[model samples]
Target: MGRLTGRQKLGWAVIAVLVFVYALFPVLSIFMTSLKSTSDIRSGTFLPPKVSWENYQQILTAEGGARDLFLPALRNSIGISLIATAIAVVLATLAAYGIARLDFRGKKLILTTALGVSIFPVISIVTPLFNLWRNIGLYDTWPGLIIPYLSLTLPISIWTLAAFFRQIPWELEQAAQVDGATPWQAFRKAIVPLAAPGVFTTALIAFFIAWNDFVYGISLTSTSAARPVPAALAFFTGASYFELPVGAISAASIIVTIPVVVLVVLFQRQIVSGLTQGAVKG
Candidate 1:
């Protein structure tokens, strides 16, 4: 391909700037709101009059129950998301390997079903899951949330890992066996190394899915015991019903978003590799 002309470069630069603004606007607005005082928030200005850290401190150490509820909810979110991601990655890895390497009837059907389940509207199942969890005694517990998260995370994990697995050169496994390596040894030494990036990427995606969940978290758990941050944020308030907590909510949102940003920044390369592993023709 020929290099772009100056005019073409300028056009693309403008487009990039617009897209960046569109994506960054919401985050910037939230951060700015977090820096404002309650009176400034009532003024409804996008930029705060002055920087204030009191919103952060208020949520962290309020005399009332904000700190108690927020901290436990944060821990619940972290613990539940980690547990769901671990289980989803393990199960999806094994399932992807089988679907990629082994021949079986109805394989395509299985994949289609998983895809369908993943795309199914979560709201549609809330009523059923609510009743089911309450009946089985999984209600208001970590497993109550974690189990529903699997339904969301597992299908994506399987599809992504399967795509990556297909890109691996099967000849390497044969070569390992030719060198007198056992079947299990060949898989460990030859196959897993190539698949590690995909596994890591799947884990990240799974974690994000479970972490971002709100409907299940809210519908299933009545208290902070199993409620994630997103659901718990709904209960935040100022002094009373008349006093809304815009600043505190914004601060809490910014705090919750930091870990997701960190994870994406630190693992951008592996995420890209896993996503594009099988896209090209060899």
Candidate 2:
């Protein structure tokens, strides 16, 4: 290997430092701010005199059942994310299987139409969906939010899974069929396990999409009983219009963020592969 000049090493180090700061700054800032009291938050220093756990306590046990909504929101977020992701995975895998394996009329057109739906603006269709939900008395409920979330999750799932399926060795499926396994059994016993990485990748994408959505959650769930964390977190504001407690808000944000971070860490390799599943030719 050729030795690098000191100046070249310094240049690369500087670039690495910049990238690290860009990624870590906001996260560090959120955590640091979460530790400060309201007064120190207003003072706005990069560092604080002390760290506190009171904010976490408040969020966990805030106003009787009202403030405790954070727990429910967290639960709802998990529940909703899991249900939506499972449904999306099943539907997307089946659809991808057909597109990747079967011969059908207008296959190109159907695939194009499926991909096209992902491009439509959510805002344009949200109002119509809200009205429809209201008429059917589904508004202000978890289903209202879940159904709309599918609109975002399903298309992306299909696209990614379809790409992944294209990368699979078709000989595996053929050999399983030759061994007398039915199509469904082959899919269940072989394809699904082999596709775990891609499925998890798709599920994470869907989960985060639903977890982080604010517009539909706010629009569809009118009360705290149904509002997810994103909507419920808005209440940490003061009477004079300024936010009530930055620390409490940060604590809440930390609580909400940890699960996604954990999932990502656990599935980091899968995500990396799934993201690049279609870039190579078969």
Candidate 3:
């Protein structure tokens, strides 16, 4: 890459701003809509004349409203996503280390197969998974959702961690052994620390994939017991036939989105390192 001229840099900056605005417009619109009352929403204003907390209150406190359902879905999302992420990261770490460090036949094939599986459309498996879960008594439960989420999270975790692992200098393990460290201790204290950023980044990615899932969540779950926030939001409605719970939906959407934003902000550096490391390698 070459350094850009002043005009070129200015042009790139403009493009970046435009892209940012394009992506941010919808989120801003949703926040603005969430703050509006029903009447203000009906008026179809981009920004509300005055902000009202009624929408949030209704969703949180009203009987037969989102609170009864939303809370469970939120819990389910958090629980399932965390569980899936933890499981995926642990398995991925081991698999990645093996792929990167150990010589074995079919290693490339395994990586390629995992890549293929990761890109497989979730919709294609929904019907079959539905039937399988029902037959196995996994339908409409947390396990149903969590099991399906593995199909998505696991592959990405393996791929990213493997890339990061490959970048590690294997000589450190030997160096630690020479220093009287046991194999397990050498790995735990040496490799683990060096790979922490990549592992943390993989965890974040896996969690996001699991948390933001809507297709599997909606397809596999029938009740609030296992439904996640994204899926539960579909069932929310206004009190009457003539009304819509747009404000409440927006508020709920914002609430769920906050966690993702916070997580990204907190782990941005690790995320960048993991992604770049993975991309730079095979």
Candidate 4:
């Protein structure tokens, strides 16, 4: 490609700045809101009159505020999201390997079913799942949320990993086996390293899905026993029935958002490479 002229470079720079602001403006707004005192939040100003950590204190340490609600919900969100991500990645890696390396009668059927399930509305099945979980004594439990989360995480994980697997040369595995490695050993030492980027990317995506789920988190759990951060946010209350906990909610949102931002910034290269390679063949 030829080098860009100065005008073209300036145009592209402007577009990049515009996109960055568009994407991060809401997050900036939330951060500003989080710094506002409860009274300042209602002052209808974009910037706080005076910065205050009261909102953060309310959720993080204050007495008779959101400390109780936020802490438990944060723990539940982390534990549940991690568990679901790990399970989905392991299952998806194995399933995608089979789909990529094997020729089976039902291969296409399995892919189609996975695709269908991923696209199916979560709301549609919540009623049935709610009743079923209640009957089976799984309601308001970790497993209750984890199983439903698999339904969300698995399909996309399979699709992404399968695409990535297809791009890896089969000869590498054969070469490993010829060196006296067992099939499992060959996969563990050789294939797993090669597929690490894709697997990591898939796990992140799956975690985000499970982490952000509100309907299932709210409808399935009656208490903090299984409620995640997203659903628990809804239960935040103000000092009085007539007031709102807007600042506290914003502070909580900023806290939850920090981990996601850190992950993306840390693994951006891997995420980009994995996605690009996965898309190359499919």
Which numbered prediction scores highest in lDDT against the true structure? 4
| Model 4: residue 28 alpha-carbon error in angstroms | 0.7
Query: In model 4, which residue pairs have backbone atoms overlapping below 3 Å?
Result: none
Off-target runs (Cα >4 Å) in candidate 4 are: none
Q: Write the per-residue lDDT of candidate 3 for residues 1-282, one digit (tens) a residue.
A: 999999999999999999999999999999999999988987867889999988888778877778887888999999999999999999999899999999999999999999999999999999999999999999999888888899999999998999999888899998999999998899889998999989999999999999999999999989998999999999997878899899999999999999999999988988898788767754
Q: Which 10 consecutive positions of candidate 1 have the poorest summed lDDT?
A: 273-282
Question: TM-score for model 2?
Answer: 0.90
Model 1, 161-199: lDDT tens digits are 888888888899999999999988987889988999999
Off by over 4 Å in 3: 1-3
- CA-lDDT, candidates in order: 0.91, 0.81, 0.91, 0.95
Instruction: State the lDDT of candidate 2 residue by residue for 112-203, as single tens digits.
Output: 88778877777788788888988998887778777888888898888888888888898998899999999999888878888888888888
Highest TM-score: give the candidate number: 4
Q: Model 4: per-residue lDDT, tens digit, 171-223?
A: 99999999999999999999999999999999999999998899899999989
- Model 4 C-alpha RMSD vs. true structure (Å) is 1.2
- Candidate 4 C-alpha error for residue 24, in Å: 0.5
Per-model clash counts, in order, read 0, 0, 0, 0
Pairs in steric clash, model 2? none
- Model 2 lDDT at residue 256: 88
Taking all chains together, each candidate's TM-score versus the true structure is 0.96, 0.90, 0.95, 0.97
Give candidate 2 misplaced runs (Cα > 4 Å): 1-14, 239-243
